[model samples]
Target: MSETAPAASPSAVPLIRCRGLERAYGTASARTVALAGVDLDVVKGERIAMVGPSGSGKSTLLHLIGAMDAPDKGGVVVAGRDLARFDDAAAARFRREEIGFVFQFFNLVPTLSSLDNVALPARLAGKGASEAQAAAQKLLDRVGLGNRAADFPDALSGGQQQRVAVARALVNEPQIVLADEPTGALDRRTGEEILALLGEVVRERGATLLMATHSDAAVSIATRLLSVEDGRITEDRALTPITAPIKEHA
Candidate 1:
């Protein structure tokens, strides 16, 4: 959140920019402030871990970046598009075409097979059935779930379901991925596995990853750490580069 923070690279343009972002809940008299004057610049391909205590606006900021919620004050500019100017339909289109989302609970359709669940986003993005299936299959294979493509969410293990969720997020070939506590529901070892896969896929696609998490395992994959406190960024620092590749966890 500093103008003096070392730049991402020679490209001074940020893929995402949040200026004075503010969001709150409830009526003003009893309102809860979620974000207050947060300013951040995210360059392309940067992996950012947003860490904060509960109720500190970590999720609120992620929602704003992904167009899941509107900011009460200030604005967000993503890929040169001003989010405040987007209508409901436009926002939906943007999310479908440009941003991928991974959640803690997986959120796959209960009745859909793994392949179908993974292909859902691509279908919504207007890809044909065969194309969507192919993309979904590739992602599933990448996550080591290709053989389980026909299985439904309820039939899969927690780690497998999350792998499917990760595949679903990437099916559209989105440039940005927004994950909200993606491994919060998994055990420690499982969480580590999921994070490793998430990091690998994002890197493979050259996509930016913005995750809100409390887990140190989640933080390990990030190139930068952002600490949020009381609705504002309290710290932003670079992480040491990982010389060794993250081991395959599954």
Candidate 2:
């Protein structure tokens, strides 16, 4: 593993910081390095896209930042707290309250209605059922799915389900949102819509967003782009302003 990267400058605290992060899987003979001394810093409200081929560690980095998993070496700091130092309980609390995650598959409970699916996190955090459902409804409205709130995930279209997933991620009003190929399972048009909704919602909330995806449409929506290759960040650059697609008259 490489030496730890220096801490972020004190002038402006980064919302997410990774220092010499490393993770490996399997036995010595079959070891696979998922991350190799990676370093990164993301400011609040920035939309960062991690693009890479399969097995390039984009998801691994996001997982580490989201505190879903611990690194084998080095550390991750989010919202000024070191994730490496968090005890199991602390880690669980941090994930539940401070961070939001959207996965490639809509991980909604099949038995739950869209409103319940979005409200589940808040319920888990101790909010009253009515209050949580109210918040979830507003988020669904924001995602253009207000009419589908009472429907179960099985009854919704893939796009609608993914929109519900986005709503669920925002229910807690977290400081950061992490998405792993959030639009991967959808068609190109649907994926574009999801990306636009994600960008709009995260920007409106003033929350940081870190997404791992291979879609160029997804990359275009990001303010910054990072390319991961062979477990290392090979390119990091600010993207030019992204204009909304032009609409043709009917």
Candidate 3:
């Protein structure tokens, strides 16, 4: 079948689009449905929160859009690149260069220093070691982790580790950032700090954010909210929205 989606007007073109998306696991008798016929379009510069109960398909939708998993019956397109057309290598390249991800677990490499962990994606995208480290250092400084660059994941506090994760996500300068429960591992105070930093940097970079979360802190910065339930999107609405960061005095 052609990967064509129903035509959208030029002005309404989305940076990410999902259509008839369906995903399931297990055999028919014991199958578990994750997403059922989800249709979503995300324009650039919007912060959207995908919220629901733990098993409500939010993460499944994230995984599909992030190229971590595939839909059973439909397709996803991001930045006009059809995810269905991506082979393993293409998907890796796409993920390395086109999108970023921050997970609940602060998935940093245990053995790599904080700087290396953040630099991994840029390096994978074919940067020289110095170039990748330079970019990583800049982001670490942005996330308030410049001093911790040489520390390994084991040496950092939970909040610090998450800061590293955030820096890592932005290292590639991706147009889209997918975060799943990004603050789940941090304490309340730390979570808020990280979320604020995240929102600030993403807004400054003009990148779109799609996060699957249950935290009010995450929702507070969102421009749109999507509530998924029992494998489908049940509600989508606009919120107060995140405006650009206020300029600071010199």
**Candidates' C-alpha lDDT:** 0.92, 0.88, 0.89
| Tens digits of per-residue lDDT for model 1, 85-160 | 9999999999999999999999999999999999999998889999999999999999999999999999999999
**TM-scores across all candidates?**
0.96, 0.93, 0.92
- Judged by whole-model lDDT over C-alpha atoms, candidate 2 comes out at 0.88
> What lDDT tens digits, residue by residue, belong to model 2 across residues 1-250?
3355332234777888899999999999999999988998888878989999999999889889988898999899888899988888988899999988999988999999999999999999999999999999999998889999889999999989999999999999999999999989999888888888888888888898999997888766788889999899999877863656322121
What tens-digit string does per-residue lDDT give for candidate 3 at 1-250?
A: 4445433344878999899999999999999999889999998988998899989999999999999999999999998999999999999888888788999999999999999999999988889999999999999999888999999999999989999998999999999999999988887777877777788888889999999888887777788889999999999877886565533221
Candidate 3 clashes between residue pairs 3 or more apart in a chain or in different chains: none
For candidate 2, give the lDDT of residue 36. Answer: 87
Model 1 off-target regions past 4 Å?
1-5
RMSD of 1: 2.0
Which numbered prediction scores highest in lDDT against the true structure? 1
Best to worst by TM-score, what's the order? 1, 2, 3
lDDT of model 1 at residue 145?
Answer: 95
